[model samples]
Target chain A: GAGVSQSPSNKVTEKGKDVELRCDPISGHTALYWYRQRLGQGLEFLIYFQGNSAPDKSGLPSDRFSAERTGESVSTLTIQRTQQEDSAVYLCASSLGQGLSYEQYFGPGTRLTVT
Target chain B: AQSVTQLDSQVPVFEEAPVELRCNYSSSVSVYLFWYVQYPNQGLQLLLKYLSGSTLVKGINGFEAEFNKSQTSFHLRKPSVHISDTAEYFCAVISVSGGYQKVTFGIGTKLQVIP
Candidate 1:
């Protein structure tokens, strides 16, 4: 029983470059979530996916930020033409969908730096 | 609109001493409350949650929080905190609307446990 896992652990890109952060959640978890944490702030909800339902992308700051989860296994969060403000830790979490199981398992986030 | 507020941005306490971190939220409808801990360079981990039942909810790492509906506050408490307790704590609220779950988080409270 492994917990959620994120790739790269760190990402460094230029101001105008694009970056993609990947997340691999635990098996059989039907709900996935993405969050961002700035340097000295709390976690900010970015998006959430529950099974085949349409994702809740309202938390996304702008249209430039987009995420996609393939079939409930992996998710990728992409930032286009990243800006300095886009630098933050992107975290992924998984939970048992349906019912009232709100307990989520988190992964070590990917630290993104836009220089 | 729902929002979370964490007044104290930082709290310093001696090892083995009791500690308290306050959290408050404003919402007209029902909501699920949660407390999460984030170690340095790690993702957020669930500390406790208050959905229904007992107002005083106990969580991992000797942490507990009392949910006060009248006060609209959920304050986390630990009788004896260790050095390992030094981390960032976040209070979050999730409410469903329009067939989507919306999560709102407060500015994290950094706990510094002194030796």
Candidate 2:
């Protein structure tokens, strides 16, 4: 893809249900990132992946939230037991390199709603 | 550890008027600053970034920002805003190490340009 792409533009589920979000980053991008934006709130960092290196999960809110990336191409974020607080727009971004100065390209984001 | 603060939650201005969105950041180490804009039902797009060199950085749509090291602030400004410039603006900072590259975002400021 020419840019970062996210799946399932919107998802509605009951509380405590599990959900999965997918992200396909731009081709040749070595760094991928996940973020969450609650309604009228700032974006919260979730996780980051740099090529085959170990992913940094320090940003994950809890054990219920986990993410995985395969060979720097595609990634998936899973929420085991979703809560109302989990309702937000899940955003995915990819960068050409691993430096903080590198520019990031973002996806359209997936809106998740927990009723 | 880093944090960004956007003082104003919303700013309303008339078309052809100038506008400024204030952003402040706190970090123990050197970091890069960025500004992103999000339209309705869309993802974030990088407006500009300040890495090094001159303190003044110009970006798309005639937007520019200045990095003030003494004040720890990077405020975005536009000479004249158009109706199409209405959007949510976010300020972000990435750590110098870039290992995790955690981007801490501000609560965003909604810019409304009325004709």
Over A6-43, each residue of candidate 2 has an lDDT whose tens digit, in order, gives 99999999999999999999999999999999999988
lDDT, candidate 2, B14-111, per-residue tens? 99999999999999988889999998877899999999999999999999999999999999999999999999999999884645566788999999
* Tens digits of per-residue lDDT for model 1, A1-115: 8999999899999999989999999999998999998888788889999888999898899999999999989999999999999999898998887465777889999999999
Candidate 1 local distance difference test against the native: 0.92
lDDT of 1 by residue, B1-115 (tens): 8999999999999999999999999998888899999887667889999989999999999999999999999999999999999999999887877666777889999999999
Docking class of 2: medium
TM-score, predicted candidate 1 vs. hidden true structure: 0.95
lDDT of each: 0.92, 0.92
Candidate 1, RMSD to the unseen true structure: 1.3
Candidate 1 recovers a fraction of native contacts equal to 0.79
**Judged by TM-score, which candidate is best?**
2
